[model samples]
Every structure is written in structure tokens, then in C-alpha cells.
Target: MARPRRIVLLRHGESVGNVDDTVYEREPDHALALTAKGRSQAEDAGRALRAVFDGERISAYVSPYRRTHQTFQSLGLDPAKVRVREEPRLREQDWGNWQDRDDVRRQKAYRDAYGHFFYRFAQGESGADVYDRVGAFLESLWRSFEDPHHPPNVLIVTHGLTMRLFCMRWFHWTVAEFESLSNPDNAEWRTLLLGPDGRYSLDRPFDRWCEPESYGVTG
Candidate 1:
């Protein structure tokens, strides 16, 4: 498959749920809206992206979640030039039932002690499940790359975990390597540039939780 000139992976700005975990307990994840600060952040991100592209046309794949959609809308890109599509697979990890504060704290502690990759929420999904969906998404992306009409540059607006899982699947990283990586900050983006060799490489470094001396183990 012919790679796109560049792939920009962006996390949605802070949502209402980001400011208050309890909001997740009260509202569905898909319905959560962005906060005022989140809106500002999204605008800033859009400006930054515009500066990076320098008036080039790009395609956007946005998560179906309200916050993600809102973020894309806030980007201020030329709608006539940029094609936008909703991608369900780009949604955030399902958390199932609305969680209580105690449950949320307990689960965090357990996941920290054990592992985030394998931890499954009650009636929800594990990181492995997300990885599976991300892998499938990549397959679809590759097919798009083969299309002559596909855009040369692509933008993805998704969740932090989704972004991480996409990178993991794209790079074929092991669980240990995945564990070492940290999620990008809200409204932050990472770029993958296709090189002359026809392979894509990350443009920046990520924070590593696990050091080289302690591979496969938490620091």
C-alpha cells in the first residue's frame, strides 16, 4: 500500500468528563461535550494544524463521539477543500456502566499494580480489545492508501487511548513497549511522516514509563 505523505493523530481537547471523572458516571461517553477551556484548546490546535499544513488540503477521520466531532468542527479548516468522515472505530474505549468514584479509584489502583494492557473494566473492554479494533482500522486505512483518489495527507481526531493503540498496532510494538509509552496530552498531536523508503516514522518522542534497564516491568 502506498503511504500517505503524512498522518496526524490528534487527541480531542479536554471534555466535561476530563475535568470531572464523576461526569462519566452520569453521562454517556459518546454524549459528553467539550468544556469552555476545551473549546479554546481545540481552536488553538486547529490553528497549529493549519500552520503545519500551510494551506494544503487534507482529509479528516473523526471519532463519532461528540467531543471529537466538536474538536474537528472547531479546527476551522476549509470545509469545501477538506473531506471529513466519521469513524466509529476511533471512539474512546468503552467503559460500560457508569462508574462510581470508589470503583474508578479501585480500578485505577488495580490497573496500576497489574497492567493497563490486560485490565478489563466491568462489562467493558480491555486494551487488547481496542488494539484489535485499531488493527482493523489500519487495514481500512491501507485500503484507502491504495485508492488513487484518496487524499495525500490525513488527520485523525480520536481519544488518547485510541491514539496510543493506533501507534501500537502501526508499529507492531510488544506489550512491554506499549506499556512504556504514555498517552498524549489533551489537544496534543503526533505526526507520522512517510519517508523515501515508503515507511512511516513518528516525528517526535514519547514519554516512557519503563526504562531500558527494567524491560517488561513498571518503573
Candidate 2:
């Protein structure tokens, strides 16, 4: 085995912070929990997964954020069948001190004006930083694929931006291509299947479409 036969990237369902962006102003990002509807969405996602997997064992790598863990729990996958691991590298981008600031709108505007991929927030990580970590994770994934004991199916539960960056890194998409991708909806998922060439290919187009914007920034 040189590549996982199947890979599923899932975004966590709506969290308290998603319902009220201002919650991050007071609560730590990692502490944000899921909403009631988010739980339902997670269960729905689990049912969809069960339909696809059909009793096949899966290895899951979940972000350390509370909401992601809660989403995984809500998926209702059998603990005896699915192997779960907490992956810090899959955690949400570190907003650092920016989380407590009230200027998120302005910061987002600045990022949009400049470049989301390279703009580093004040004392925070950039999209490129996240890409680097995800690249490392991909390398580890390839190694896992070569292991005899590795599971055939893999699941990764992570944040929206992280999921986008993971695809960019995995597929070697250009910055323009990366920027043109919108975040997947809460609890949404995408699949990749290993091809005959021993490489993974997207099973389908993203659920959402994004248009390319001219952000007056080069490289």
C-alpha cells in the first residue's frame, strides 16, 4: 500500500463562535463548543459516512479544538472500529492576540486587500505557516499509507481554512487557485480516492464555488 484508498476531510459543525463571532473576544478559541444544530449536523455527517464506509474501519485524525472533538463524538462512529487521534497540527490557525481585538473586520479587509496566503496577523500565524504544517502532515500520511497496519480509510476533522490549505498543499494548487477556494460549509466533507497511479484524486468538485479576486499583491 502506497496511498490510502480513501481520504475524507470533514469540517466541524457550527460552533458557538460561528453563531456569534464575538464569542472569541472572551472565550479561548480552543474552548468554543458546538451548538445544538451543529451536533445534529455531525450526526448527519456520521450517517453519510456510515453509508459510504459500510462497516469498514477508519482512522481519524481530529483537530484538538473542543468543537472538532465534539463533532467527532457526535458522529457516533463505533469506538471499536474507528481509531481516533488528536492532531495538534490540524488545529485552527492561531489568531494569537488578535482574537481579543475588535478589529477583525478591518483585519479581514486588510487580508483580502493584500493576500490571505502570506499576510501574517499581529503575532499570529499566516496561511503559509498552516500550509507548512499541513505539508508535514501529508508526508506523515504517505508514510502511514505504506505501513501494513495502517487503515484503508482515513478521516480528518479540521477547520475551514485548514481544510482549504490542506488541499492547496496536497494538490500543489497555485496561490490564485487557493485564493479562489471558499470554505466548506459547517460539517461539510470532501473525499479523495487513490488512483491507479498511486496518487489521490478529488472525488468531486467542492460544494461551494469561489471567484478569483484581484488582490493587488504579488507572490
Candidate 3:
């Protein structure tokens, strides 16, 4: 096969940040840990992933963020059969330093007014910036495909936004297409299965989200 037999992108389990915006006021986003339920979610997700792998070895690229690292550990995959690497490119979209909740909310409104792809977060990155790094990460991934020792299955444990950008880069989706897609649920994963033709197809395409304010409907 020209590429791995499968490429699975797994969003990290729910973190403290998911339930409490105040966590960002105290802890760095990169350092947040998963919630108790999130640990359970990762365990279930791991079982589901094993079913998908069906005895094949796993080659995993995990984001360096604490939550993702914890998620990867919780998966319970055989450490002996899985090769793991910490990939910073797989980290969450940075909102920058300790967050002020109200300010973050205001920025999101501005982001909505602009476009998802182009809206640069203050002291952080625009989606385009993330896209560039994800693209670079893909180049390295392709290079890894050339090695005979590369495992047959690949898993990426990362953030939801990073996962979407990954599919955008790999599938060559347009900005509109990207914008229309919703993120995978926390601890949920989307798979890319390799067919006989050496191409990849999503096990299920991402769900679509409506732009409620679009189409100029006046209230």
C-alpha cells in the first residue's frame, strides 16, 4: 500500500476546560487534564479503536498537550505494538495565555463576523496558521510512509480543530467545505480506510453545521 491501511484521527477526551471556563483563568490550556468521565470515554474509545485495528499494530502520533497525552495513555493499547510520537502540530488551536472568559466570548463573536478560516485569535493563531503547520505535519507523515518499518495502522490523538484541519489538508477540501464541517465529538474519532486503489475514504464524513446567520434573514 502507498500509505498506511488506516488513518484514525481521535479527538482528546473531555477536559476540565470543557465544563469550566474558569480553568483557563488558572491553568494553561496545554496543561489541563481530562475529567473523570473523559477518562471513561477514552477507555471506551480505545476498545472501539482496537476493534477497528483488528490486531494490526498501531503507529500513533499524540499531541503534546496534557489532555491528549492522558487520553493516549487511557486508550489501553498494547505499548509493545504501538509506536508513539509526540507531535506539537497536533495541539489545540491556541487561544494564547490565561484566558479571560468574557474576552474570549467577544473574540468568538468577532470570529463569527469574519470567517472561521481567517479569523486570527488575539495573541493566538488564526485557523490559517494552524492549517500551515498541519500541512507541514502532513509532509512529514508522507515521508514516514516511505519507511518499510512504518506500521500498517496510524492513529492521531489530538484536538478537534486540529483533526478538522488535518482532513482539510489531506482531502483538499475548500474553505467553504471546511467551514461547513463540524468537529468530531470529544473522544470520538473519524477513520480513513484505504481501499484497493490506494486512496483513502472517510468511514463516515464529518457532520455539517449550519451558519444560522447566513442567507440574510432579518429577525
Q: Write the residue-wise lDDT of candidate 1 on 1-219 in tens digits.
A: 545689999999989998888887788889999999998999999999998877776889999999999999888988876888899988888878677867878887888777778998877888989999988888888888887777778999999988988988888777777777889888999999999987889999667877533455441
Q: How well is each residue in 16-58 modelled by candidate 2, as lDDT tens digits?
A: 9988888878888999999999999999999999888778789
How does candidate 2 fare on TM-score? 0.92
Order of candidate numbers by lDDT, starting with the best: 3, 2, 1
Superior candidate under TM-score, 1 versus 2:
1
TM-score of each: 0.93, 0.92, 0.94
Model 3, range 1-219, lDDT digits (tens) per residue? Answer: 247889999999999999999889999999999999999999999998888888788889999999999999999998888999999988889898989999999998999889888999899999999999999999999999988878999999999889889998888877777788888899999988999988898989888986433443332
Return the candidate ranking by TM-score, descending. 3, 1, 2
Error of 2 at 102 (Å): 2.4
- Candidate 1 residue 187 Cα shift, in angstroms, is 0.4
- Lowest lDDT sum, 10 consecutive residues, model 2, at 210-219
Give model 2 RMSD, 1 decimal. 2.8
Worst 10 residues of 1 by lDDT: 210-219
